[model samples]
Target: MPDPELPVITLEELGVLRAVHVRGTDSVEVELTPTYTGCPAIEAMSTDIERVLREHGMRKVSVHTVLSPAWSTDDISAEGRRKLREFGIAPPRVRQASGPKEPVAVELGPTRTSRPVAGPPELAPVPDPVCCPHCGSADTELLSRFSSTACKALRRCLACREPFDHFKEL
Candidate 1:
């Protein structure tokens, strides 16, 4: 069930929630996808989940990896979002189209209408409509694309002049 107090994130943002199941009379299995293909927490997370399941009487627990659907922030439960915000990271923005536009061609000839040459592809997702956690300000600026952790980015609110971490959309 979804929680009401928090925002929502796509599954890609959550990265993976790996299905857990029983493999035998007392065994359990789980599937997962690393956040960046080589997440360092996989081993620890797997161990913790398995141990918890075993303590609940499961004899065995196995982990399986799935890469097709590719996780997204959309799958994050509302409760999870609350946890993230409570942990000081802003939840990812909801997915929405920015409106229709023409695609740029590689050829440099004057084939399109009047417009300046486009720049390289954006490496990071667009900034969230972020509000300051400290003073509830809408004015904010990106301080760094990467934070102390791989999943977060550093930002500062112009109104409150407070720095914060934002959970980047995957």
Candidate 2:
């Protein structure tokens, strides 16, 4: 099915279409995972999927949204990354192993006992450097944290002097 957000890419290409199960000759069920929670395109995507199936003579079409396995940038297909780049949107960068280190205990008031101290891991935002899709340059600056959508950020390339959208990593 077609993706409602990026029309050039199919839902499979975007890696959001999870599964398709045929219940019978005229019945079908589809599973989808949204790229982000409360993504505006999700309802549109569901409607589009149902409409597409009905147009093809499917009597019963059901679209289920599953969120158990959270969506990640890594889930995006390689072709999807290429397509994003081709469309002037930088795909998410490969995550490195250099995320914030785990917390350590610190002694207090010369006491033998100490408690571990650190912010919640979930609250830490690991900033990944985005490359420029236009010139493939790593010398890019964040123009804004929010782009055209919540799932993206605006960036500008120093090399090409071109502004582009970056698919932010979740």
Candidate 3:
């Protein structure tokens, strides 16, 4: 089924449909992983899954949320990424197999911020450029840390002057 928010992708494409198990030939149990903690779409997805199963003549349907191992952006299928781009949304960058290389160093000097920060000057390392899904240009600027969903960030492409949502990494 298509995701309620991002209808361009399916639950399996989003990598949240972790597993399904048949128990005692009468009931079925589904395992799901949320994109992030406290994801609101999780409930809707679960309900949809249960309803669909029920329609298929399954009386007992259960959807169990899984948190262990966590959900990673890398879980997004290649088809999902293509779909996101086709739908004008920037998909999350594929994480390096070698893992993140750059580490945000704690600067002991004055940093660029309006308020006096308490912790490290840079809370996170400079993120890789979020390319424009429409123009496929790397010239983009982050508009907000959060967008329509917590799992996505708002970004504007400098090349095409278009605003789009980018699936957040991790």
lDDT of 2 by residue, 133-165 (tens): 888887887777778888887888889899999
Candidate 1 regions with alpha-carbon error over 4 angstroms = 1-15, 96-128
Alpha carbon deviation, residue 115, candidate 3 (Å): 21
Best model per TM-score: 3
lDDT of 1 by residue, 6-75 (tens): 2243333354656767677898788876565776766665676677777889887887767756655555
TM-score, candidate 2, is 0.79
Assess the local accuracy of residue 107 in candidate 3 as a C-alpha lDDT between 0 and 100. 35
RMSD of 3: 5.6
Residue pairs with backbone overlap in model 2: none
lDDT of each: 0.61, 0.79, 0.83
Q: Model 2, 36: alpha-carbon shift in Å?
A: 1.7
User: lDDT by residue for model 3 over 7-110, one digit each (tens)?
Assistant: 99999999998999988666899999998889899999999999998898888999999997687888889999999999988999877555644432343333
Q: lDDT (0-100) at residue 23 of candidate 3? A: 82
lDDT rank order: 3, 2, 1
Candidate 3 lDDT: 0.83
* Residues forming the 10-long window of minimal summed lDDT in candidate 2: 107-116
